[model samples]
Target: MKTEPDAFSLEDLRQRGREPWEGIRNYQARNFLRGMRIGDGVFIYHSRVAAPGIVGTAEVVTTAYPDPTQFDPQSKYYDAASSLARPRWDLVDVAYRHTLAKPFPLERLRALPEFADSPLVRKGNRLSIVPITANQWDRVLQPAR
Candidate 1:
C-alpha cells in the first residue's frame, strides 16, 4: 500500500508483498474501501510527485475496517465527528506481485486518444485508488514487440 515513503517508484512497489493498505482518511477513499472485495486487483500507482505513474500490481487480500488512526484523538487523521459504533475511515490490504519492467508512463496514457475519457489519466485527477479495465490494463502492459 505504501509504495514508498517519499517517492513510489516501480522498484519500491515491487517489494511490498501482501501489505495492508491503511491510513486512508478521505471520505471517497473510505467508501472505496468499504465496497472493496477480496482478490480485487489494484494498479499500484505513484503519487505526490511530478512523474507519477503505474508501478506494479497488487491484489486485495483483506476486507474493510476502521482505521486505527481514526480512533486516536492525537492522530491527525482522527475524526472528532466519528463514533465507536460508526468509524469514519476504512482500508483494504494489497499484496504486491510484480512490477512492470517498463512501466507505461502517465504521460503516455494522457497522450492516448483512447484514454481521452479515462479518469486515471485525466488532467488534475488525483484520486489515489482507481479502477482499471481489462483492456486498458492489457494495453498498458503490452510488451514491446
Candidate 2:
C-alpha cells in the first residue's frame, strides 16, 4: 500500500508494530483492502516524495472491517453517506514485517520486464493498492533473497 512518508512512513509501522490501515476513500482501493486475508504480505510504498519507492513490507493481520473514520465527523476521511449498517469504507490491520535493505525505486521497477504490464508501472496510474502478479512479487523480493 502507498502512503505519503510525511503522513505515515515504514518507520511508523515498525515503531507501532501494527496499525489499522484506514482512510481509504476510493472504491477500488477499498475493495482491495476488503480482499486482503490474514497473513497476506503487503509492500509498503512511500509516495509523493522525491524518490518514491517500496520501503518495506507488512503482513495483513486482520480481515476487512468497516473503517470507523468514515463515520466520524471529526476525521478528514469522514463520509456523511456512510452509516453503521451500510458502511462505505473498509480497512485491514497490518503488522510490520521488515524494511527492505535497499528500497525499490519506482523508476527502476517501471523498467523491469516483470512489471511491464503492472498498473504500478503504468504512466498516470494512481491506484494506491494495486494487485501485483506473482512474478512481479518475486522480482521485487529478489534482491532480498
Candidate 3:
C-alpha cells in the first residue's frame, strides 16, 4: 500500500512568493500542513495545466501557521469569520529546489510497475497534497540517481 506524492504547479509556487500560502480550502490539504514537520520533503508538482508531473523538490521551511486567507473576507480562500483568535486552517513553508533535468512525467510513473499502482499517478484522483512513502520517494528520484 502506497500513498502518492502531492503535486504543485509552477504558477502556484510563484504565487508563494506573493502570498506565502493561500487558496487551500480543503481540510485534508490543511491537515497535511498541520502534520508537516520542518525539513520534510516535497515533490513539487504541476497541476491544473498541461504536462503535469514532478518538476522539482521543495523543503518544508516552517511549521504550521494560521492561514491568513481564512481571515480575509475579500480573499478567495477567506473563511469569512476565521480569525487569529480562532483560525480554521493552517499551512507550512516550503522552498524550491533545482528543477529536475527530466521531469518524472505522469507517463513514466504509470509505465513503471512500482509506480503504476501509486495513488498519485492513477487517474481520477487529485489530492493537492499526498504523502510520499520512503520507498516511493526513492523511485521517483531514482532516475535522477
**TM-score ranking, high to low:** 2, 1, 3
Q: Candidate 1 — which pairs collide?
A: 18-95
What overall lDDT goes with each candidate model?
Answer: 0.69, 0.90, 0.68
Q: How accurate is candidate 2 locally (lDDT)?
A: 0.90
Model 2 over residues 1-145: C-alpha lDDT tens digits? 9999899999999999999998888899988888888988899999999999888899999999999999999999999998999988999999999999999999989889988887887889789998766787778888654
Can you list the residue pairs that collide in candidate 3?
A: 8-45
Off by over 4 Å in 3: 1-19, 113-117
Weakest 10 consecutive residues of candidate 1 by summed lDDT:
1-10
lDDT ranking, best first: 2, 1, 3
Candidate 2 stretches with Cα past 4 Å from truth are none
Stretches of candidate 1 exceeding 4 Å from the true structure:
1-16
Better of 1 and 2 by TM-score: 2
Candidate 2, RMSD to the unseen true structure = 1.3
For model 3, how does the per-residue alpha-carbon lDDT over 25-84 read when each residue is reduced to its tens digit?
Answer: 677777877888888887777665456677767777888898777887787788866778
- The candidate 2 region of ten consecutive residues with least summed lDDT is 136-145
